[model samples]
Target: MNERNHISIREAIRGRITDGEWAPGAMMPGETDLAEEYGCSRTTVNRALQKLAEDGLIERKRRAGTRVREIPSRQAKFRIPILRHEIEAAGGAYSSRVAFRETLKAPGFIQSRLRLATGARVLRLHTVHLSDGQPYAFEDRWVNIKAAPGVVDAPFDIISANEWLVREVPYSSGDVRFSAMAAGQIEAQALATSLGAPLFTVERTTWLRDLYITTTKLCYRPGYHMRTEL
Candidate 1:
């Protein structure tokens, strides 16, 4: 999918953060300055910086202005790896709760994106991610049963599909993308935040050889930040 205007602004801001135009803990340009620089409105700059604040990539305050956060950025690289283990490595207590689960027909968009054949079935999972006791993320995922057959009847009460796949399934390659978006009502509720909250959106397409494995859309909390070092 093509990026929206806010996402384009997000990329530009992320680029500046990555390029050292704004150092850690350094204050950033005001909304008016940024708007003038980007040839957009203050609302657009607000939307972009709001997204960065939500992602925990930057800290914003009234009067004090926005500043590059002192946090490290070693968490944004995609290397076809495991999600559950990644969570564990971050030193946060990782847990998952199933919000919705079903075996359903893949939608036309999903079918085309996953390159599934007609009549193919997909196992769908709607999950909430928890770090310690706080809500962290909401996951909407679809797995190709033809690729991971056991998911058809898999029990998610004890383990998550991500954790299970990392332990049992081996994938060859994957593609991933990230963006910024306003959270819908339901997503905001599940994430324990307010409506229209800014969120970090991550989408991934994974394949095992030529077989499509799974695709997932992950919506992170208003304070979730991802960073990576070169």
Candidate 2:
């Protein structure tokens, strides 16, 4: 019904588990029953359970139903960094430009990565983030139009797609990778670095439930460092 309703149901269920009313390994009531008990819609109950699952408080199985985890899972959560905020936090002015934008049939590699149909069309963008007017990172991104149709008309020039997606899209699951790679021609040019120079890189793919949303690779300027807290 509303945000508060969803949160209340989640907390109610969480309290049951925490207070030993629903012991560890106990099967949780189905969404239909929970909805009736809470006097809310089944969709609201589902959302609450989904959040609990994400938080590692419960486990959900296709046909086995939901249950409180015997031993709650411990997961390392990483927040997607906003490039502009990152630069500003470091006491540098932030700016960005979209170097390229196009919509075309996904390439073979892109199709495989996103698990798209052979002829699926995607909106592709190349952007360079600048700090103090110097190149800081180069981003190459592909958005699945079917999953995020709003991106078709979004203005990447005004606000980078990275920030836009983070605000507008809510992902259920995602994968991220960090590595070092020699700069390619496009990445080198965009980052204003020498070709073949070693660069810090990040690749991420996001999905909303079963639907693929976007995938992107960010190549950072040389000497860049990344830190995260567990």
Candidate 3:
């Protein structure tokens, strides 16, 4: 089915559930019935239901079929800003340099994070982001070679890995963490701050389907803040 039809059918199903036509704990219509109602193939209905399942609107089981949850799961929605946009918004010229880049054996921690086998090789990168010639953020990133093989040839020197990956890879899910930490000697020097100064840090891990994409940690200089409207 077309993308328009897919969206309409998904919205229709969601409307029914939210409007109480399908009450909490109620079983959803079978795929065949839903397809007939939407005048589409079962594949289209399946796709719509899959999206609802992913959004936590419904649950599906192999033998038990699909049902509306007693309570919809809470979902957090936020936009992942591009770094350049954020810098430009602050009225600063954005610039970055590849401080370090290499291909080597994945470390134990990185291997576990990406579920890679022993001796797996990964691409490592360290970057220093600048705003108007002042230090902004320090980036430490690792790319899963098995998942993004083409990254081996990407021109990271010209375009940052963060920007390139965001454009090249389509992620289905990700995890993000934010915290305040005292900058280490290396971090302080890279960020042009005093040693042990407080810095805001963000760690992000992304995946496309089951394939690991990349893991990155961004440590920002003092006074950095992240705000998002719900």
Top-scoring candidate (TM-score): 3
Question: Tens-digit lDDT track for model 2 on 116-152?
Answer: 9999999999999999999999999999998888998
Query: Please, what are the lDDT tens digits per residue for candidate 1 over residues 82-175?
Result: 5556677877788888898888888998899889998899998998988776787898899998888888777776888887765556644678
Candidate 2 error regions (>4 Å): 1-78
In candidate 1 the C-alpha lDDT for residue 121 amounts to 93
lDDT of 3 by residue, 134-216 (tens): 99999999999988888888998778898898888855478999898899987898998999999999899998887888899
Task: Say which prediction, candidate 1 or candidate 2, comes out ahead on lDDT.
Answer: 2
CA lDDT of each prediction against the hidden true structure: 0.82, 0.90, 0.88
* TM-score of every candidate: 0.63, 0.66, 0.67
Best by lDDT: 2
RMSD in Å for model 1:
15.4
Q: lDDT at 180 for candidate 2?
A: 97
lDDT of 3 at 56: 85
**Number of clashing pairs, model 3?**
0
Quote the lDDT for 52 in model 2: 90
The deviation in Å at residue 224 for candidate 2 is 0.3
| Candidate 1 wrong stretches, greater than 4 Å | 1-83
